[model samples]
Target: MNSERDALTEILAWRRHGDPNISAVEAPVVKMVVFAVGDTLFAFPGASVTEILPMTTIYWVPGCPSSLEGVINVRGDVTSVIRLGDLLGVEHVTEDGRTAILLGHGNAMCSGLRVDRVLDVLDVLEERIQPPLSTLPERFQPWATGMFAYQGRSVLALDLGRLFQDYRAGLA
Candidate 1:
């Protein structure tokens, strides 16, 4: 089996049209970096992300869910940021050290999810995706639309709409 680095290299090459064997028949699989909240891996689609910035000042909103880290002013837009780990019921996103992903969720819903770090961006065929795992908790299961194998790793494809809905409901 190829090492993770090797797989990434090959995938990158394939994306750059370096390999003739792999033909992207459909709209090229969008690239994304998969991150972890404990053992669970979550993907942030590259297209939705506006920027990944180092931890910055966040105004805390009292009475908010523990998953909510705080609100940030990103590029003049005040965006509500949620700790990716906390929302998943995993580790707490550290305030002093972490990465904040500014995501643009269309229609002015959820603006972004703060994560620990970006793992890697890989191209995954949409056709190869399978429905979310049946073993996941029923309530949280809908947050992920499906999973796809990328560079020998299973990358969860998050449904932004479902995540937005869940978070919005949590606020109410």
Candidate 2:
């Protein structure tokens, strides 16, 4: 069994470094704005994110969705912070509060998102996106536009607009 495992590892290493004919040309890197919701990591197209603000107390509004945590003052401007997990109906992200991700969707209205932490900016390519499987949880399906293999893990690419637009429309 040990020998078989060693052989498999050797073959994989060879395929990664020695297979010149099977080179997968690297994709043009685009910035990925990363954030954490609970322990899971996620990202949006960096261009879509305008700013990340520290966790601050919010002013609650009546008759809003449970996912809409509340509004925070961003440099004198009030912006609502959406609880990312609540919007997706993710139970693990049941923690009630987080920092704000002030996002502007291509000149559309700007809003804030409550996230656990903001990870570093990463660069990935369009070709790196893999289709989301139908087997994903129903709650997660609407938000996960696609998945990307970054480093050794599969990172879900979020559809920020899906979460943002409907809420903004409500305010209009």
Q: Show where candidate 2 strays beyond 4 Å.
A: 1-26, 92-107, 168-172
Per model, how many backbone clashes are there? 0, 0
Write down the lDDT of every candidate, Cα atoms only. Answer: 0.68, 0.72
Q: Per-residue lDDT tens digits of candidate 2, residues 38-82?
A: 766678888888887777878899998877778888788887777
Winner by lDDT: 2
Candidate 1 residue 83 Cα shift, in angstroms, is 1.4
Tens-place lDDT per residue, model 1, 1-172, is 8456787787898777757965645565666667655555677676656666667788899997767767888778798887776666667444345454646473357566777766666676666778888886664566677787756777677766567776677631
Model 1 misplacement above 4 A: 1-28, 93-98
Instruction: Give the TM-scores of the predictions, in the order they appear.
Output: 0.71, 0.71
